[model samples]
Target: MSTKTVAGNYFEDFTIGQEIVHATPRTVTEGDIALYTALYGSRFAATSAATFAESMGLERMPVDSLLAFHLVFGKTVPDISLNAVANLGYAGGVFGVPLYPGDTVTTTSTVIGLKENSNGRSGVVYVRSVGTNQKGEMVLDYIRWVMVNKGNLDAPAPEIVIPDLPGAVAAEDLKVPYDLAGRDYDTVLAGSPYLWDDYEVGERIDHVDGMTIEEAEHMLATRLYQNTAKVHFNQHAQAQAKIGRRLIYGGHIISLARALTFNGLANGQSIAAINAGAHANPTFAGDTVYAWSEVLERIELPGRTDIGALRLRTVATKDLPCADFPYRGEDGKYLPQVVLDLDYTVLIPRR
Candidate 1:
């Protein structure tokens, strides 16, 4: 069976500068859009309706940013993190062209950094992956580090290298895929009255809703993205681990939290970039998730008056509400209830 089956990569097998072209390009479909909306109940107009997208000067409505992100990220999992302990963090994520249905996305990645854990049982691998459409247009570009188990405990550790990542995606570097072009934007239909100019730096918003994860629902979400992460699927394997159940995919929490943002940030229509993110804690089935966001900075484009950007910090927690905005503790670690800490940028109309 040595050449008949694939067991996936382990920590010791990775090296810096290695380029990996991931398998399987996925075509986005209206069916994918429908299932995603049913799972998260996302209501962003520009992505929700083709008519609303035309009003925003786009030829066709785009899929949700997080959906595009998940599809791309899923493509990298088998080669990058199949025998993984956890996916640690993400940084410098930039979304380029709008991903409309029928666009096929393919992903390729490069090993940028590697560090063996002190225990010799695991190590961290940093990879930069780029997802491009069949037209060769970039869809999503980002960096992520994952902690992976070592299949051979006796294998020697390689030279430790950690890539220097950006603190945030600079405003000048943001990609504005489309302009409003003086078209009419209906606030009432969009579900929010607030615009770019109405929000202030450091303003916090509680999304004011909670959703409990179901065992079947999390599995469906994982499969919908075609994310073949064993930890998310194999309850038998996970039952032996400390968590003792099927682990919920981290992207599930990101999508759920992003969906909750609609209640307060409905007008923050398009995601431009993901500066950074961390899954502070693991989430399992039956845990109720809630979310909130803080405006970190406001960005004005150099020559555009139709729209602007907001650097946002959106936090998601399990079994805790964000009324007081739960986050880092006195020790600088995230609160136990916190599941996701995401720093991203979104575009909103300028009123």
Candidate 2:
């Protein structure tokens, strides 16, 4: 009897070029940092110690990049992915200024691409979102696409418009903070002696650690980000579907893989950009996650000898060790044990 109740946007409800400003600006806090460290076991020195960060020319310890990413991504869930089937992939992601505690973040998204599925029950929606701090400075930006269910099967298909996106952020375009230069870093406090020049291209490092996922840990991590996706929380609903259990958020696996890398890559101080990423398979509670990394490329910043960038491919697997590099089958299909395949860049001190 009332048309007031609001359901989230469905596939058929979207129009290309529409702009949606998400609600609820969130303020970063020390509590968020503590909870994130507890959940992911991240040990990046720049984000873990204010004194160490200040020694490297930062004003204070910055929030973990993935933490900032999850927060901004959470803001778009209700307006963009609430009725989604799955988050498909990501591309052309770039981080701007470092986020510190007490800074507030807000987001806006624009629909950039759309394609109807042949099955007629679902379609893909692509959106580019920009997250900005209270000072109106952009903190992060990225393009993500999701598969969303249709609210009306009979609705006529909208004109398809797929945006042409970059495969990677250009090396020259990466912004290294001005204060993060000068090579005055402390190796002892940073937790590793490896520097930019120490890593050779084509080298692979198995992180040699595994952490079994617990139901409560993932639930708490997802809730802390304010992510309200039902597939991550509703077990009864998921029990009726394929997989038969709640799916662990892919970002959770990303953070776990990043944390495990501290064993070998602790000196790789900060994330520069995310070139591409894919959640190859779903993860569930009780799966033991392991990680491995391959150095793809190395770039020297034009004017700065203080730091350089390493292009890395970090792979996460469940119940499988990465000693032999378990990636895909001969036919190019991901193995059942493989859960994440991420390609990104990180900045490390130069010797």
Candidate 3:
């Protein structure tokens, strides 16, 4: 719980096989679901109306895949990117399993490669992080790269090794929740703006509003991820486990954080690139989710910047007006209300 600042630096600081353990585990809840549905306008039947999900063969719609990825990644920030200069890219990502409403999420990383910038001021570090549930089953995995500052040229160079990763997941790897098969579309109630084609790069959007999550809300999300590690669902679990009440789902925080980023970042609709990101601490229910963003880097691909890449940060909390907010409690640990800290790259339209 020390409040010391972290010193991060250039590629020279990273070894090909070092592992980073992020601090704090999170629980998921129902509030996370309601906010996700309200903010993103995603109408996957399983996620929204519960009745629809039951028909699809699920106990309930599981958290979205991107949401799950964000939660796991968010936990790695303070330990990994406090000094990051830029996010580079993503690869070899996979969704390992379904997440439920009351589960705890934890993450770990293995360094893959380190490439020093010819200029020596900065370099890129590639890493693969995996997210796991309470039972220790893999929930999500992905590869990412980041630009880091080189504080000193004298820093020793470490061995560089890259990992082999798959592009998209095979259908079999996808764990469709119980009872979820065919979807029930709610065209009238669902507010979809762009359908793959409607997006153009450089366009920014505001997600509009925020919502507060309750303890129960987060518990539900953790359970949905099938992250049954007790700390997320039972108070008794915390007494014996040393964790507090059922933790909030890292994915719930991710979704809420991403939704909060709608303002100023709405134009970057597609997630063309995932340079790198992390969840700084555990977020619980009763935290209000809020967000804002910046356009960090862009690229022109073939005939288009039509879809551009944007580096962004999305933070969540237990109350309103989280813009320019502060994290950390007097004890030096995360505040009870603060939920998340995230950074990533998204695709935007440039038409």
Give the per-residue Cα lDDT of candidate 3 at 11.
54
Question: What is candidate 3's lDDT per residue for 1-351, written digit by digit as tens?
Answer: 785955543456677778988778878777766655654444343445666545545576667556667678767655555445534455556556577779788999988777777776777788888999999988877787766666687776555455564543332333323321244433233234332244344333335467676776565555433443333455774666455555555556666666555443433433433434445555556666665444443444343322334444445565656555556667876565555545455543333
- The true-versus-predicted C-alpha distance at residue 18 of model 1, in Å, is 0.6
Instruction: Choose the strongest candidate by lDDT.
Output: 1
Best by TM-score: 1
Tens digit of lDDT per residue, candidate 2, span 184-298? Answer: 7888888999999999999999999999999999999889988777688777767765648888988899999999999899988888888999899999999999999999999
Writing each residue's lDDT as its tens digit, candidate 1 over 1-351 gives 479888899999999999999999999999999999999999999999999988888888999999999999999999999888889899999999999899999999999999999999999999999999999999999999999999999999999999999788887888887678668889999999999999999999999999999998889898988888789988887777765787788999999999999999999888999999999999998999999999999999878898899999999999999998659889999999999999999999998
Report the alpha-carbon TM-score of model 2 versus the true structure: 0.96
lDDT of 1: 0.93
Model 3 TM-score (2 dp): 0.51
Q: Is candidate 1 or candidate 3 better by lDDT?
A: 1
Which candidate model has the greater lDDT, 1 or 2?
1
TM-score of each: 0.98, 0.96, 0.51
Could you tell me the lDDT of residue 135 within candidate 1? Answer: 100
lDDT of each: 0.93, 0.89, 0.56
